[model samples]
Target: MEKHIHNTSLFSKSAALTLTAVNVILFFITEAFPSVRAYLSLNSVLIIHGRMYWQFISYMFVHGSLMHLLGNMLGLVFFGTAVERKLGTKQFLILYFSSGLASGALSFAVYAAAGMNHVFLLGASGAVYAVLLVFSVLFPRTLIYLWGLLPVPAPILVAVFALIEIFSQLFSVNSGIAHTTHLSGFAAAWLYVKIRMKKSPLALWKEAYRK
Candidate 1:
C-alpha cells in the first residue's frame, strides 16, 4: 500500500490538470445551457425519484457560479498538485473521488432525512476540502497564505476550517453553502488517510510541530 501510494510511475496523466480543465469547460457549457445544470447537480428528488444517479459523480464537476468554480480550481491547483506529486496520481485520484462520492452519499442521506428534496448540491468544494486535509497531513509543517497575506501552517488551517464548518452547520444551516458536505469531506479524507495510508493525521501533525 505504501509503495502504491508513493509510486508516481503508476500513472502518467495529471489528474489535477485534467480535473481543472473539465471543471472549467463544464462551467462554461453549463452556463450557456442552464438546463444542463439540473442533470449535473445533485438533487435528492431527482436521484431518488427520477433515478438520476449519475449526479453523484457529475456534481463534483459542476459549480453554481464563477466564483465557486474558481475557488475550487485554485485549491485543486495549489494543494492537489503537491499531493499528487507526493502520493502519486493514483492515490490522489482515489482521495479526490472517494472523498467526493462519500460526501455526496452522506449528504443525500441527510437531505433525504431532513426533507430537503429540492436542495441541489453542486461544486467540488467537498473533494477540494479532502485534498486540503490530506495536504496538511502529508505536509503538516508547510505554510499556506490566507488570501495571500497571513501565513498559517497547513494543519492549523485545516483545523480552523473544520471549526468554521462545524459552526456554520450548527448555527447557519440555511447558508446555502453545504457546510455539512464540507465537514463530510473532511471526515471522508481523514478516514482515507487513516485506513488507506495507515497514518494518523493527528500524530503526523504533532510530530511535525515538535520539530
Candidate 2:
C-alpha cells in the first residue's frame, strides 16, 4: 500500500490528464486563440512581456496535434506505467520533468546555434522518450508490438528508433517531427536513471546505519 501510494502521488493520473488537456487546448490556441498562443509559446526573445522561461516547462504539455499527442502519450501509457511501477510515482515524475527540461534546453541551444530563432520546439515527446528509455534499460528483453503489427524486441526497436532519428536529421525530413529532441530526452533520462540507481534505498540505509 505504501508503495502504491508513492506511485500514485509520483505518477499522478491528474498530471497526465492535465498535460493531455493542455495539448488539446494548444490546438485550439494555435487554431482559434491567436492571443492565447502568443502567451503559451516558447518566445525566448519576446517582443512584448510574457512568460519567458515558460517554454522550458510549458513545451512538455503543449503538443502540435491530436496525432502527435496520441503517439507520445501512447508511449507513456505503455512504458511509463512500467517505469512508474518500478520507481514509484515521485521518482517517475522527477525523471519525466528533468528529461523534459534537458530536451527543451538541447532543442533551444541547437536552434539558436543554427540561427533558427523564430522556431519554437514544443511537445511532451522529450519526457515520454525518457520514460521509454528507462523502460528499455530496466526491461531490455520486453517485447513491443510495432504499431501493433510486427513484434520486435524492445531494446532493438529502441536502438532502431535512435539510429533513425540521428540519420534522418541529416536529410531534411518532411514529417516535421522533433526526433532530435526525443533522442536528446532519451539520452538524458538514461543518464539520470544511471545516477539514481547507484544509491538504492537499501544502500543508503546501510551507509547511514554504518556511520
Candidate 3:
C-alpha cells in the first residue's frame, strides 16, 4: 500500500514540473524568435475570422513578460503540484487544459460583446487560477502567506482574488490583466470540482445555510 501510494504521488509532481519547464522553455524560445509569438500567442480577430482556434491552447504556454512567466510558474509549482496529487495526473491535465480552453472561449465572447474583438490575450493565468482555486477548495483551512508574512486561510484568499478580478472586469480597468479570463477559470474550475465530487454546485451553499 505504501509503494502504491508513493507511485501515485510521483506522477503528479513530475507532471507539474514538466508543465512549469515547458512554460519557461517556450518563453525563452519566443524571446529568441519573436516571430514565433504570432503563431503561438492569442489574436482575437484572427481567431474569429481566420479560424486560428489553436490559439486557445497555444496561448496558455506563452507569456507576455519575464515577470508574468515567473509569477505563473511559481503558482504552477506551488498549487499545481498539490492539486495534481489530489486529482492524479490524468485528471490534473484535464483540469488544467479544460479550464484554459474555457477561459479562452469566455474571453472571446466578452471581447466580441464589448466590440473589442481585436484585443488579444496571452498567458497561463487562467489555468493557474483554476489550480489555485482547486487548492483552496481541497485545503480550505490551510494558511497561505501573503508576501511571506500575513497568513490567510486558503478559501478566504481565493475569495479575495475572485472578488478583485470581478471588480476589475466590471470597471474595465486599465490594469492590462485579463480579469474576465481569470473569473472564467474560477467558474470553470468550480463547476468541474462540483461534478468531480458528484455534488451540485449549490450544495456547499446549502450546507452552509443549514449550518
Candidate 4:
C-alpha cells in the first residue's frame, strides 16, 4: 500500500473559511464578557503559575490584547485549517485543546515546583504553536512572510523563534513573550502527533527533531 501523501497549502477555501468564523467568534465572546473571564487571564500567583484548572481549555479562546488575538487568530487560520482538514476536524480539535491544556499544565507545574502560588494564562497561542509545529513537520519547504517585508522558510522561522525565545528567557530583562508556554505548546503538539501516528515522538525526532 502506498502512503497517502497530501498537499499542505494553507491558502485554501476551507481553511480560510474556518479561520474567519473562529476569529469573529473569539473576538465577540471575549469582548462581550470581561468580568467572568478575569480568572481566565494568564497571571503568576505568589508562587504558582498559569492558573490552570478547567480554564485551561477556555483560556485558549481568550486573549489579553487586541494584537495578541489578531496575531494568534491569523496564525490559526493560516496554519491550522489546512492541517485540520488533513487530520479531520475532530482530530484537529482534539490536538488543539489538548495542546492548550498541556501548555497550561506544564506552566503550572513549573511554577508550583518553584513554590509559586497560582498563575493565570490565556490566549490561543498554544493552539497556534501546535499549528506551527504541524506545518513545520509536514511541509518543511513552506515559506512564511515575516513582518510584511522579509520572507523566510518555515523551518528556519521556527528554529529562529525557538532560539530567540530561549535566549530571552535566559537573559532578556523585559521580554513579554511567553517562551515557556510556547515550548510547552510545541511539546504538546509533538505528543499529539506521536500518539495519533503511533510513532515515538523521540524516534521521530531523528527525522525532524522538531516540535
Q: What lDDT score belongs to each candidate, Candidate 1 first?
A: 0.92, 0.71, 0.85, 0.69
Q: Across residues 10-31, which tens digit of lDDT does each residue of candidate 1 receive?
A: 2246789888989999999999
- Clashing pairs in model 1, backbone N/Cα/C closer than 3 A: none
User: Worst lDDT window (10 residues) for model 2?
Assistant: 199-208
Per-residue accuracy of model 3 over 38-103 as CA lDDT, tens digit each: 778777787878898899899999998999999999999999988888888899899999999999
Off by over 4 Å in 4: 1-26, 42-52, 115-118, 172-175, 197-211
Best by lDDT: 1
Candidate 1 residue spans exceeding 4 A from truth: 1-12
Candidates sorted on lDDT, descending: 1, 3, 2, 4
TM-score of 3: 0.87
Model 3 stretches with alpha carbons more than 4 Å out: 1-13, 200-211
Report the C-alpha lDDT of model 2 over 11-123, residue by residue, as the tens digit.
Answer: 24544544555566777667675565555555445422343777778777766667877888777777877787788778888888999989888887777667776776767
Model 3 steric clash pairs: none
Q: TM-scores across all candidates? A: 0.92, 0.78, 0.87, 0.74
Quote the positional error of residue 2 for candidate 1 in Å.
Answer: 27
